[model samples]
Target: MSILSGILITLIFLGIFISPIIGIIAGPKIQWNNQMKDSCEYFDTRISMGTHFPESQYNIRSLDQSVHDQTFFLAPVFAPQADITAKYQYYHRFSGNTANTAHLAIDVDLENAIWRMMELDGPDERTKWAAVGRKRDNAALPAFENVNQTVIYNGTIEQLGPHLWIPDFMMLIQGIDDARQHCEIEPFIRVFDVQGAPIEYYESLIQPKWNWSPEWDEYLMMRTASFGLGRQRLDMCVRENNFRTFEFEEDKYKGVSDISFVPLAIIASYRMRFSEIGRLDCSKDIMDKARDMI
Candidate 1:
């Protein structure tokens, strides 16, 4: 090929490669920067607080009290309830402990038969009993732990339940007046999209209806407060993409630990049914901008 032809080809290739870069750097307008700015403002206006909850409370328990009497407790482990509006108000009024009112409980149904079996001779004995005296001296017998290891083992239930019960044997074993006294908190974060919409607004569309336990009140409060703070932090990021921000202070409560005050931004996407397109699109755009800023 001639020298001129070679030079022409190289120039064309270079232009093709560098054109996009130049466009990105010097385009008439890229909406991302403006979008980010708007997102930050949106989050700032939306977020009202920041808070933390423990990691244990997110497990949902079945509400059926009747399920406990059977040999196998029937239920499913699922996401903790995120509704805080009603529970928070009730806790604030009744318990006077507002910091953790938004919490949810980890419900585990204790089978009466399993509880009785465990009490009769401890876990090892229960394992032997399950073996029907065939493996009384089996080495594996001592290794068995929990009701799951017994003959009539049932799965764990982690969903919201109506009535939570602690088997009498469990109360005696744990030295607690009732199983209801043992509450757990799950770790969760609540934030707003850059457009100032609360995360709970998104959650409520998909979550199930369940009753709240007094034990979960504090968890709920912290989660609600975090959503508020997340809104603020998201706002700050949108305004100044390079700037760093964080929660100023976080308060602690009984049974809650390892509180985090770091700044965070999250991007999530969900396919909305055609009927729900309008709201989803608006919310998704706001969330996308917030994510970019972060």
Candidate 2:
């Protein structure tokens, strides 16, 4: 063949081989870049930090006095309501003479995590895992529709266990909803020093890491059966990974406690609308329990 003919043949082969590979890689890269841009805009504009953090936001003296005063001072008491769902309607109807102590029940929903393990696409800076897919993404993130309220907790982090560091000091939180019978609650922590500078921020949507016991599943099944809901339908809702129960280990961080005032922020779906539904008086018994929990 002539030199031109040979060169033309080589070019044709390269196009056939390289074009497909380029198309395959480029398609996802372009799509992911667009998705990331959408995600960033969504988070920045829609999500609220809940509390206004001023320049002296971290300063102890300069902190919001109202928030500081309420922290660890008042117990979150769910007010009486007759309009609630049938599941918890009994709790209100039967409590004529009983102390409103049932309000102290802490049903924290930690399974609905707002952040996820993100694998970024190199060159494109797009996420390898799309947050769109419910199962395929493998990581869950908070979205505008999913989040309703924003709460901030100011407190100090103390060593709970060898590897567990939890906020153990004065805690301030806002936008807590007692109305919802079932909702996701996410808590964010902002630790500040005496100098009014932030130390660290921790936020997570927690799911129960432990496997559900057969006994637990059985109990749930029995409860749903009473409601006339089919067992199969309830089974679909009761995913083992969806729920977790949390309780503070009083024995763990008992004393020699280093107190630091930090802020805990949360965005939840329920609103603490107690205007119409009067708040229960913070009785000595209730206040004592609330203090102990903190």
Candidate 3:
């Protein structure tokens, strides 16, 4: 064969070899980029933060001075009927008395999520891990929409039956709902449709506060969550990995002791809303878990 003919033949063979390899590396890179974009846009907006920092914001001070704790408060509570769902109306928002104490419930559609777990997609940014699948834990949910097929078909959860995703904090929320049903006078309760993200991009969406800890200041979060102006410190969940060293394990700096401030924020807000309901103890288990954390 002539020199030009051999060169041409080699070029053709190389193209065939390299094409699939390029695809193999590029495919995940492309998906990763898309996920980053989605997570970025989702967190940057008020969708995630509005669960606490509302948009149509009526002052928590409410133009009422008897209520304290408003110095540096950033996570002001959204009024019960405000347009919290301005971006998506799939949810039903309403508030009324369960017996005498104020009771607020916002039943989320269970089909949308802030991160979406790469499962369902839509306009709402709720913690809608329900309807994703129906496990015995979630039989109360509506018919299975199979919103998230990835987890159900994956053998690990197959035997557990179709499982739904409920955040750890909802245990407290649900327990509060029960306490309101039977207890005497209790602080008002609001079941937020919100998931755990913030107004800024974080490394993990699944974690409380999306694991946004910038330093080893969980103690700061605990102290701040109870104070009006201090609640902004509650914006972090688990301590950053860099803080998870010998000191953290030995309790020098504290580990996940404050498992999450999400619960504390809920409880503290209840105390604020009902100034008389001091030491709000609706859910014993949850309150115990959050006692020191709050």
Top TM-score hit: 3
Query: Who wins the lDDT comparison?
Result: 3
Ranking by lDDT: 3, 1, 2
The number of clashing residue pairs in model 1 is 31
The backbone clash count of each candidate, in order, is 31, 21, 1
Q: Estimate each model's TM-score.
A: 0.16, 0.16, 0.19
lDDT of 2 by residue, 171-252 (tens): 3221122112112111111111112113332222111221112122111211010011111111001111111112222222
Candidates, ranked, TM-score: 3, 1, 2
Q: Write the per-residue lDDT of candidate 1 for residues 1-294, one digit (tens) a residue.
A: 699999999999999999899777755334333322322221211222111111111112112332111011111222334664222111100001111223111122222111111111222333233323433466343444543312211122111231211222111111111112221111122221121225564344123342222122211211221112112211111111112112323333322211111111001101111112333322345556667999
RMSD of each: 21.0, 24.4, 23.9
C-alpha displacement of 216 in model 1, angstroms? 35
How much is the lDDT of residue 158 in candidate 3? 11
In model 3, pairs of residues that clash are 135-162
Estimate the overall C-alpha local distance difference test score of candidate 3. Answer: 0.26
Question: Which of the two candidates, 1 or 2, achieves a greater TM-score against the reference?
Answer: 1
